[model samples]
Target: MIHVVFNEPDVTVINQAIELDENLKGDVVLIRDDYAVGPIQNLYLGEGREARKQWWSAVLAGGDYDGKADSGEVDDYKTVAELVGTMRRNPDEIIWIWAAQNKHDVSGYYWLLHFMKEFQGRVFILYLNNLPFINEKGQLFYPTWLSTIPPKEFLKAKKLARPITLSEFEVDPDEWIRLANEGKQVRILEGGKKLSQYGEEYYDEELKKFITGDWQKASKVINQFLSKARQTTGDAYLLWRLKKIVSGEGYDVQGEMKAMKDFEVKQKVGQPA
Candidate 1:
């Protein structure tokens, strides 16, 4: 069975994967890092319900929710615990796909990935930036912090795949909703996953190694990389685009995608469809 836990939930890719096999209706699934359930930051989107509540609690406690951007740190919600509980309950399922925006707070994410890989599940990852790797005497090793992997080792997917820029993981939207209609679970998580990658000679291990111990550095590298990629990618605009295709109820896709924001959300979800 193919199970996908996409970070960004690309409509085209999600749709196409489901089309790859009818069983995808039952095969694919999703889960989040226990940290994901907390209030989001750095990125400029509204928080999820859990995050909103926590933010207000801080305000009530006089801890400050509307602090200046560059001011002192705000305590984040502990969604990682929530994610951990979910994984412990369903450890057998192999994850065909997954993603993350940061690495330091990803123990739950990495633990699950290793478990799935050990079980020989098809594993694919869509990290915000390139998956980390180290080279030793022509050996390529990607480190997973959940468990300390040795420096000169290698871990390739036995039945797993991940999205890289030149070779992105693809899924089709129309097909995904079809599976959703069939009583299968294809959830639209509250936020989106914007993906990018780098490898080969560009794997700059020296200046970037601090990423293994520091999220600020890793996040900085990824942001710098993606800011440049956007010069070419023009942004997939996943949420806006996906809603456009879905609003048509499978109609007017061509014209809808290029329309202005006002038009995209103009059609209601169940308007006589």
Candidate 2:
């Protein structure tokens, strides 16, 4: 069996869980792209994928992860293609896709399942949506990220795995295709397999709330927004948006724009500190 996950931290926790339960042992595949925050139009095609890569280049330019967008490190298309090849070569093999209740994971699920129809029965999903689990403190709570759940609790999560249904295999891919054609840059989970699309600037207004007339380190503003906002994105993405905010009216900027720490930003002089 192959265990597939979306994020890096999840790989660590899943590995720990495997150590505790030999039955859960499998090669773990981490899909490195965050499908929730980039262009999806014709994503399966070479030209469309290149367009999204170029867009990422712009979003990541001058940030700490500069050039990462073009790097082979973030290639999900290649990962999925290899997974498909593996499944084709060994018909007896099975795949388990693990996802938590968050835009990042669910978006990945949508993108992944679209290509998994031929292996319907062989593909299983363990979606932790609205499911409660015991944390390290022994307190029960719903987790938005898989990495937040105690490694021992993964044994319990294992029971939730079920083969991807015929209905889902039919309906879900259509939904993903629709989302791709819509050509939006951001996706938000509405609930259970449902996603709503939004412009790339969806978080800009909320991000600006942290900026005031007093200039603050760009890193500080991004860190605070990630901590305080109900909805948040990666620091790199936020820093990109903050730079856009600085370039437009209503924000004052100083210092180099090479990276988050290299810059400072604030509300324009008369905007109130």
Candidate 3:
């Protein structure tokens, strides 16, 4: 069996869990691209490689708010395609996808479904959208990602994996088409329904106000907000909002880079004080 997930952090957690529980020692493939936020035109069409290259070109051209392009982004997706090709060759191996409810995971799941149509292998998904989870404190919450669940809790969730029926894939292609065309930052739910789109206001309003009060670097502002706020928004989502604010408000791009560097340095040494 092959287990597939969206990001490196997820890969890390799953690997750790696999070490703890022998049942999860199957081949794990990490899809490193983020389909949630950029130009995804023709992403689900044609051969996955060429289409992915085109998409990467579009993303690179857009230039992230920090005015930098991740040169290795295209190579990362190529690696994912190679892994998927391996799955395609092993027609009898069951493929399990660990997907969350958010735009990142759901969007990636759609692309994965589109790519795996030719595989003769059975596909199963541990979809975590509406599923309720109990934290260590015994509080119930709908987790947006597998990273949010403790390793012990994840073992419990693994039992919920269900096989994907042909009908589900049949219904998703057109929905993927519609989603690729929409060009919005949002998630597609079950049965082709769109999730509520999050806007600038969706961010912590107090954080935005705090940042506007002083000319701080984007990364610094984000770090400070995450430390002070009780919300659970992911760093990627916060960084995206920070870029939007920088571009919209004409903040310095160099400062954003410095802030990011400082944050990284702090992380390497110890948590920032």
Candidate 4:
């Protein structure tokens, strides 16, 4: 079974594919993030306006089982786990849906990145560009003074790498900041702290102190950023360094664990949560 994400711009295409395919195997877990503004915004704002209030659900609100949410407000569906339970009871195929126009969808992706750890199927992304090509009326353009051309600074933007397990890289945060500043990459393998060369057991213990222990979400965001970085730099080393930083934070060193862990500690940095 395949898990497809029909993120916005390409929703119509995804729906069309579903209609054309008489009998496609696997289930579809449709995830409509709060960022999915309806027809009005689509007609007016191409990429100018942020998704409406509903868009915050992935980052703030909870998930909703009913597609027909009568409450008028969105349930912040922050993690795939929230949706996974709903799909568990359904026999139909599952596919996670989000919209590209809404940056909030990235938050959903962050959630899905960690979901891979607990989820049993393969995950994939599809670029749906149904809207116009260029944004003519943006508030600001790319800062040419600091412009980093893609092909030279890195490679292409669209390349898929197999999800790397979080257990590979082993190092301290002090070391991690050092590596990140140096432009190196790390890709850690999957394993527990006891197996790690770095002594990170204390870090894990500290992580448990939070009310919402979301290390998985944290790792997912870092990986998402690193994966994109690796694609840009075309540097295997950069990816390798990321592995170290992610693995060292130390918890469940598996898929999605990085993201969840990162989520917990991010807010608490420099202050008590």
**Which candidate tops lDDT?**
2
Which regions in candidate 3 have their CA more than 4 angstroms from the true location?
Answer: 44-70, 73-77, 137-139, 185-193, 196-208, 224-273
Could you tell me which residue pairs clash in candidate 3? none
Give the clashing pairs for model 2.
212-267
- Point out where model 1 deviates above 4 Å: 22-27, 32-97, 100-108, 111-273
Model 2 compared with the native: what TM-score? 0.97
TM-score of each: 0.25, 0.97, 0.71, 0.28
**Mind giving the per-residue lDDT tens digits that candidate 1 earns over 1-273?**
344443323333444545654544434344432322223232112434344445434322311223321242322222323433444567654344434333322322432432332233234454423345444345554432212222122132222344222222222222222322343211222223321222211222222221222223222333344454312111112222233234444222223323222121222334432
Q: Which runs in model 4 stand beyond 4 Å of their true positions? A: 1-9, 23-30, 34-73, 76-82, 86-104, 127-273
lDDT of 2 by residue, 1-273 (tens): 899999899999999999999999899999988889989888878998899899889999989999998778888888999999999999999999999999999989988987788998999999999999998888989999999999999999999999999999988878889998888888888888789999999998898889977879999999999999998877888888888888987787889987889988888767754
lDDT values, one for every candidate: 0.32, 0.90, 0.63, 0.32
Q: How many Å off is the CA of 187 in candidate 4?
A: 25
User: How close to the true structure is residue 7 of candidate 2, measured as C-alpha lDDT?
Assistant: 89
Q: Which stretches of candidate 2 lie over 4 Å from their true place?
A: none
Looking at candidate 3, the ten consecutive residues that score lowest on lDDT are 263-272
Task: Assess candidate 2 and give its lDDT.
Answer: 0.90
Q: After superposition, how far is residue 51 of candidate 4 from its true place, in Å?
A: 17
- TM-score for candidate 1, residues paired by index: 0.25
